[model samples]
Target: MNYFELDTPALLIDKEIMMDNLHSMQNYANQYNVQLRPHTKTHKMPKLARLQEELGSAGITVAKVGEAEVMANNGLKNIFIANEIVGKSKVERIRKLAETIDISFGIDNTYQVNQIEEVFEGAEKRAQVLVEIEVGEQRSGIIEENDFRTLLEAVKACKNVEFIGVFSHDGHSYKAQNIDECKELYLESVNRTLHFAKLAEEMGLKPKVVSIGSTPPFMLNFEIPNGVTEIRPGTYIFMDSSQANVIGTYDRCAATVLTTIISKPTKERVITDVGAKGITAQTRSIGHTATKGLGRIKEFDDVHIHGVFDEHAIIYNESFSNQVTIGDKVRIIPNHICPVCNLYEKAYLISEGEVVEEIAVDCRAKLQ
Candidate 1:
């Protein structure tokens, strides 16, 4: 089927560009001598994760235990939940998942470690776990090395818990003013994570994995530091508008939202069949006015989505008004591809303007 005939507001993946993204990141990892574990939370499709594995990704990283279950059931063995998993039911589920496949998750506190120990005690396989260090993301991770050691001691006390390693995310890199700042954060984040790894080794604990993640730092044409064992980047697979701003190109944006212009209320005002529910309301803070919008319009550099309703994306551009008309099909490159991916159930794979395949968002809505 022709891509133009697909239903409006559908997710689209350019086969050529997607393949290029997959291979580019994989090759980058090879050059840097670090394991590439592309986060599956961006695309949430088992098929894409498999492609990453085929391209030499050591494993796949997910955001939730439920998402891990989806990938594990689909034959993805080496999995890392890059987030903390708590609760009795959830811990038991993680134990059950460990019974079959190699899985690990992140923890920053000792309470969470206690829960993990209780669930995995006397189990056949200990629950492999990683310590999440807060390297300026100000998110969910251990900020102090002393506190990290306390948590490490707790993990050691638990016979069922195994101290796999430490990981950190340079999410603050997204707000970097320029490549120089991004590089600074990249090195700082990795060095901070490596510090913890060295601390573990000094304390007689073998830190098997030292992971650092963030698309901007890894894709800003910079080199990964030595001793950084793994890198988990998700948005590189589907280059979003925000990533484009950091990486200095949109030609690599493989995923787009295919929507049709459904309304022309005024000469300067038009609406597409996609909205916050489709392309997401998220925008990037890249210190640029053009990128401060919701998403980008393909082939129309001046056209930008200014507003969005539940099912409509509003656009206001004089050039776009003069060129586009109602009923015309358009494509949108979203600002944040991760959440935008979870908004759709399936994506149409297009090669040379033809719909070649349809892949399910197998891990969609796995919020638990």
Candidate 2:
């Protein structure tokens, strides 16, 4: 079926563009001699995650245990939950998932280590975990060397836990002013993460995986150092408006919200069927990742969504209003593809204007 015939506010993935994105990231990882563990959080689709593995991805990364369960149920063996997991219930869920797959999660403190040790006790396999170093995002991670040492000491006491490696996210790299700044921040984060990895080594713990992530650095093709074993970029799999701005083009963006014009209220005001409920009200307001307005109207030149109601996107442009009538379908390049993906139940895969397949957003509401 032709994609144009689809209903309004439908999520669309250009199959060609999406495949190119997956291959490009895989190629970059290959060239740098690092394993590509593309984060499935961007698409939240088991089908896309499996495709990444088929295209030479070493494994898949997720933001939650529920997402990991969804992926594992669909046959993804190796999974990493890239967030500091807390709670006995969550740990139990991970333990059950561990029974079937090579699963792991992040830890920034000894308290988590103790919890993991308690949960995985007497189980057949040890709980695999990675220490998260706070590299500049100012988010959840161990910041001090002494604290990291203490955490490692706690891990040493855990008979059921295995310290596999350390990981860091250079999320602040998204705020880089230009290419030079982006590269500088990216390298600094990598170096800081490596510093902690080295500390773990000095204490007799050998880290098998030194993972670093953030889409800007990889999108700009920054060099990965020798010690870094893996890259866990999530947004690269489904490039959006903000990521496109980082590289100065939308040619790499594969996802869009397909909406139809529902009204022409005024000569300069047009309304789309989708609003914040569909494309979302997300925007990249600073640095190289900054994008214009709520979302970009792909069919118009420099025209953005002026505002959005709960169920309508407003476009206030005389030229845009004059160019189209009601019932005209258009595409919107969302600012943050992660949450935008979660807003939909299914995404239509299109190639050359034809709907090739319908992919379910398997982990759409798996937020726990």
Candidate 3:
């Protein structure tokens, strides 16, 4: 079916561009001699996860147990929960999944280690875990080297837990003022991660897997220090306006939200069917090229979505109003693609500006 025939505010993915993005990331990982474990939280589609693994990714990384379960049910045997897996229910679920697949998760505290130990006790398999070190994001990760060492000791005591290695998400790279700053942050994070890995090895806990994740930093040709095993980058698969701005190119972005002009409230105001609920209100906040709206009109480069109600996106450019009329369909490049994908139930795979097929966003809202 043609994309124009679909309902308003539909999610559209350019198939050729998407494949190029995927292959480009895989090639980058290959050149660096690092395993590319593309995080599936961006697309949340098991079909795409399978495609990634087939394209030479070592495994897939997910944010939640529900997403992991979805991919596992669809035959993805190697999965990693990039985020720290807490709660007894979720720990039990991960332990069960470890029985069939090589499942690993992040641990930043002794409480989580104890919970995992309790869940996997007497089990035939142990849950492989990576100690998360906080490099700069100030998010959930072990900050002090001594704290990490203590956590590792406790993990070694757990019979059902296997120490995999160390991991860190250099998410602060998104806030970089320039490419040089991004590179600096990436290198700093990697250095800290390597330091922790060395400490673990010195304590007789040799880590086989040293992972680092962040799309912005990974895109740069930052040197991957020796012993860094895997790199998890999710947004590289289908970049949006934000990532494009970071890399200074929109040519590689493969995702867009297809919307239609529904109303011309005023000469300077045009409303589309998509709004915060569909395209999201996320905006870029770094440097002089910060995006001004929820999304940018792809066909009209100067037009920007100034505001969004629950059901409509308001475009305030008079030039756009003169160019577009009611019922005219337009494609918008969302500021962020990950959340946009989660907001939609399905996405159209477009090739050569034509809709080739529609794929379900099967893992949408699987936040449990």
Candidate 4:
């Protein structure tokens, strides 16, 4: 089947480009001697996760337990929940999953450790976890050395949980003003992560894995620190307009929303059957290469998505107006791929303009 025959606002992935992006990262990891554990949150499809594994990924990282369950049920055994899982119900779910597959999660606070310990008391295998150090994301991670020590000590006290290692996400690097700034942030984040790992060893906790994540910094530095064991960059698999700004190109972006032009309201106005609900309104505001509007038109370089209603993307450019007409189909590279993937139930894997496969987003809406 041809991609043109698919429904409007369909999610399309160029299989060749997708494979290239996957292998490029995998090869980079090998060159750096670090394990590549690409986060599945960007695609949220088991098929892509399997492809990553085939390309030498050590494992897959997910943002939620439901995603892990989806991958695990589909035979992807090695999984890591990159975010911290709290509450008895979630902890109980993790415990059950650990019994069947190699499962681990992130932790930043002591209370969460208590809940995990309480949940896996009678399980045959203890829960494996990584301490999330705040390496400039200013998000959910231990920022203070004292707090890190306290959390590590709590993990030792819990018989049901094991302190495996440390991890950090240099998300702030996305806001870097230039390549030099990006490199500085990358080194700082990695150094901080290594420092915590050293502290873990000094405190008598054998740090088995030291992981760092974030596509902007990972791609900018082009090298993972020597002591870092794993790299988890999700957006690298499906490059987006925002990521394109950071890395300086959209040549590696494999995902695009195939939309049909439904209206030509005026000489300077055109409308397509994709909007915030499809490509999303995410835009890039940082870096010299940031997108001008909501998303970039794959065929028309100067045309941009000026606005998006629930189901219609508004285009306002004389070149786009002159070139495109009603019923004509166009491909739009979204500003952000992660949330856009979540907007679709399935993605059409395309090769040479033909539909090669239909991949069900098994983890779609699995937010529990």
Best prediction by TM-score? 2
| TM-score (C-alpha, index-matched) for candidate 4 | 0.98
Off by over 4 Å in 4: none
For residue 300, give model 1's deviation from the true position in Å.
0.9
Deviation in Å, model 4, residue 54 alpha carbon: 1.2
TM-score of each: 0.98, 0.99, 0.98, 0.98
| 328-363 per-residue lDDT for model 3 (tens digits) | 999998988898999988888998878888788889
Backbone clashes (count) for model 1: 0
Model 3 / residue 225 / CA error / Å: 2.1
Q: Under the 3 Å rule for N, CA and C atoms, how many clashes does model 3 have?
A: 0
* Model 3 CA RMSD to the hidden true structure, in angstroms: 1.2
lDDT of 2: 0.93
Whole-model lDDT for model 3 versus the true structure?
A: 0.89
**lDDT tens digits by residue: candidate 1, 150-179:** 988888788888998999998888888888
Which ten residues in a row are the worst by lDDT in model 2? 292-301
| Evaluation by lDDT, superior candidate among 1 and 2 | 2
* lDDT accuracy of residue 119 in candidate 1: 79
Candidate 3: misplaced stretches above 4 Å?
none
